[model samples]
Target: MVQTTFKNNAVTLIGNEVKVGDVAPDFTVLANDLSPVSLKDSEGKIRLFSVVPSLDTGVCDAQTRKFNEVAAELGDNVIIYTVSMDLPFAQKRWCGAAGIDAVQTVSDHRDASFGEAYGVHIQHLRLLTRAIFVVDTEGKVAYVEYVPEATDHPNYEAAIEAVKALTK
Candidate 1:
């Protein structure tokens, strides 16, 4: 149970906490078109999972945009995903409005599978806490960062460097 805060108030997160060396857990999220997407879908590629509460928020928007900008430089070997509890339709709309082409926005609104499997699920709110997970080409978790505060940004530089390290 990883403890996190939303607006400085402690919140309970219910799930099996994933660590740096664990095998990246398999979970299903819905793509913009309601297609089921699993971790195995991007097998043999470096995956950066940007977990956010909701894309409608300011911090989530910035986080997704930042990764979208970096995705171009990350090369085809890397696949960046923005996971949120927002509905698939809303995610599609937000991406289009934001011009976010590089990062694929997936919705966990259906069953919160990604949230529970990744240990970022906010039990009370039914939303995921802000976090970043970098999965290597072989499906091993290389980096895990559960942002302490839901509203604050994760260590972007560190997460980017982690992916860069695996790319090399």
Candidate 2:
């Protein structure tokens, strides 16, 4: 169980963080293209899941671009998506300005249903804490990392290793 503190108060996540071998919860998010995309849509492919609070921040922006660059090297077999509470327009603009073309940017502004389902929602902040989950082709989680602090970056090296393991 991971505990997160916001505004000096700590809150516990209701469920265990999604872990290796656990089936990822299916989600419907608005893509940068403004199309509804679900976990089912990316089934049968290696997924690099990057979940962040918002795209308007420096860390979130860096995280998305870094993943986009890494995704290119991983090729078409691996699909990467960065999720946040930003609107689709903002996400699209950020990606464009950053020249991030390899990774898809998705939004959870509608209800944050995806964040709640993944147990990454920051109750008090109304934002998502940085987290990552790598779901294998069979839909089982291969790796999961919920950054201890909302202001920190996720473990990118470990996430990349997880994706590499999936390709083996």
Identify the leading candidate in terms of lDDT.
1
Question: Candidate 2: where is the Cα deviation over 4 Å?
Answer: 6-16
lDDT of 2: 0.84
TM-score of each: 0.99, 0.92
Report the C-alpha displacement of residue 21, candidate 2, in angstroms. 1.0
lDDT to native, each model: 0.95, 0.84
Best-fitting candidate, measured by TM-score? 1
Q: Give every collision pair in model 2.
A: none
Q: lDDT per residue, candidate 1, 38-148, as tens digits? A: 999999999999999999999999999999989988889999999999999999999999999999999999999999999999989999999999999999999999999
lDDT, model 1, position 164: 94
